[model samples]
Target: IISPDSVRLENGTSLCSGRLEVKSNQSTQTWSSVCQQDFDQQDAEVVCRELGCGAPSVLQGVLYGDVEPPMRTTEFQCGGHESALLDCRSSGSDRTTCSPGKPVGLTCSEPVRLVGGASRCAGTLEVKHNGEWRPVVYSDWTLKTSAAACRELDCGSAVSVGEREESSYRSVWRIRSDCVESGSALRECAAPDFSFSSSSSFLNLTCSGKPSPCWDNLQL
Candidate 1:
């Protein structure tokens, strides 16, 4: 008899829930007998122990009553231009990487990409460093820059720019902007073409542009 939480793949193989442990092939079992089994919490632990699968640390606190499993930060890499986010770390190591197509290591308190610019495997990104949310300044900000920001922010596309809120008379090159994130900062989007303003120590950014994709040299 198997637990209800068990997963039965299309191949007729069943993987019990507790530890994602593989069980005897479903085809080897009689349907009549298998259907009669029941599943419960105790069975969960048994399944995991049998399969040699360790409990997932992320769920240990909520599921197994282990209140302080461990603290960790995740990371991601996208757009193919720059580096990875801040939190992506290895299971047992303090080191982390955001290689091509991976995510960077950004903390929860830090803003990450939400909607657009995750093309080319890596690109520019933003994070709340110090006390202000600032854009990662590359050698220069271009159309690709805006697109990456918009996609990461999940704000559809870049629109326009005017003047900084701190100084409406300042030049566009002198202002920074704020980006609202959707999920990951690796989606595709355009750069901001407008001006942004800020009263606090935050940088001013209000750029608007098209929603076209950046040129991926490898794809074309």
Candidate 2:
């Protein structure tokens, strides 16, 4: 069985996000890359669960840095409900034609989490983008946008919106005012524009209730 301790995220800014790697039996005991495979979101779900993360939000290829020699390859056949990666059927294999220059990366739902608020459903909004966490700015930020973000985090309806000043400065803003629309998922929004000045203003939101599994199933 592949113990949870044997799996880890490498080169990511957070524990629940980064390139997936597994401890190997190779001579150097080096970590083996878990990218460049034919696995889909179902397989990624298993990886996140094994890492003790909430859920798989993003499954990307070659975003993380590359691996060195002795990289390992495997095919995961997960049913999308396994608790651990080893609980799924996996087969060892040589590198395939789809091998990526870097490695596969994953971002769990926790990356876009709430903070500095009264409850898990309310807080100063922060999002993990390009391996860094940045506050969402208040410029042109609207109620619809806030609702979209809250929905992205699996939080219920957006109940309120406010702003706060940051003690430290951040050069980048993860979301622009018009980036999100009503009834749209945050991932479907455009990438942030870093050209705008780092406004000291940050956005805060309060969500109405618990996560709705139906809404949470919506894809980017």
Candidate 3:
């Protein structure tokens, strides 16, 4: 049987967005890409849930890369409530290998949103990871770094950034600077659990566009 948590996304900008790959442990540890044609909307939903990401937002064939093998030809029949792909019922391969289609490439909605601000584009930043939302804490949060979140929101360019000082130490997701600048989605760049006490800071951003994705390119 494939490991329940063994499914992963590759080649896209973030963990929640990429080509689908599943690993089997019953035999030699090998990763197999799922053919796009065999994966349906419900199958995609299970993959997103298994990755602890938000709902499925985008699915297209070969968007991340070329058709890859060895492909898992089992057609997944999911009801959309299962927590993992392995728990869903599946059918054996109609073909022994991938013949006509590319592997599945998916982009789940970023589990990212702004809160307590003037609009969806402006507010204190929070990201959902591993099923929980937390403020992000990082050392290098310049406009360049902060702008990544704005672009992810499709909320145009970042207009301004502010900091908030809080009380005692609380857990936060520490982001890696290199990861954000690399154009990865903010939630995907989270490093590890972190805590900050006195004089700790949080980011509140304001974007130029109100509620829609306006800017095609992020302003430096």
Could you say which candidate leads in lDDT?
Answer: 3
* Alpha-carbon lDDT, every model: 0.26, 0.66, 0.74
> Measured by C-alpha RMSD in angstroms, how accurate is candidate 1?
20.5
Give the top-scoring candidate (TM-score).
3
- Tell me the TM-score of model 3: 0.81
* Residue pairs with backbone overlap in model 2: none
Residue-wise C-alpha lDDT for candidate 2, range 31-66, written one tens digit per residue = 777755556788877777676555776677666676
Score residue 139 of candidate 3 by CA lDDT: 65
Clashes of 2: 0
For each of the candidates, the C-alpha root-mean-square deviation to the true structure, in angstroms, is: 20.5, 11.4, 5.6
lDDT of 1 by residue, 1-220 (tens): 1223322211111121211212223566421111101222233233232322222111111121111212222211222221111112223332222122111111111133222224421232434322233343222344444554555444455543112223232222221322222222221111322354433121223334235333222110
Predicted candidate 3 versus true structure: per-residue lDDT over 92-127, tens digit per residue: 544458854578888777787878897888887777
Q: Report the error of model 1 at residue 87, Å.
A: 17
Which whole-number lDDT from 0 to 100 does residue 65 have in model 3? Answer: 85
Q: Between the candidate structures 1 and 3, which one is better when assessed by lDDT?
A: 3
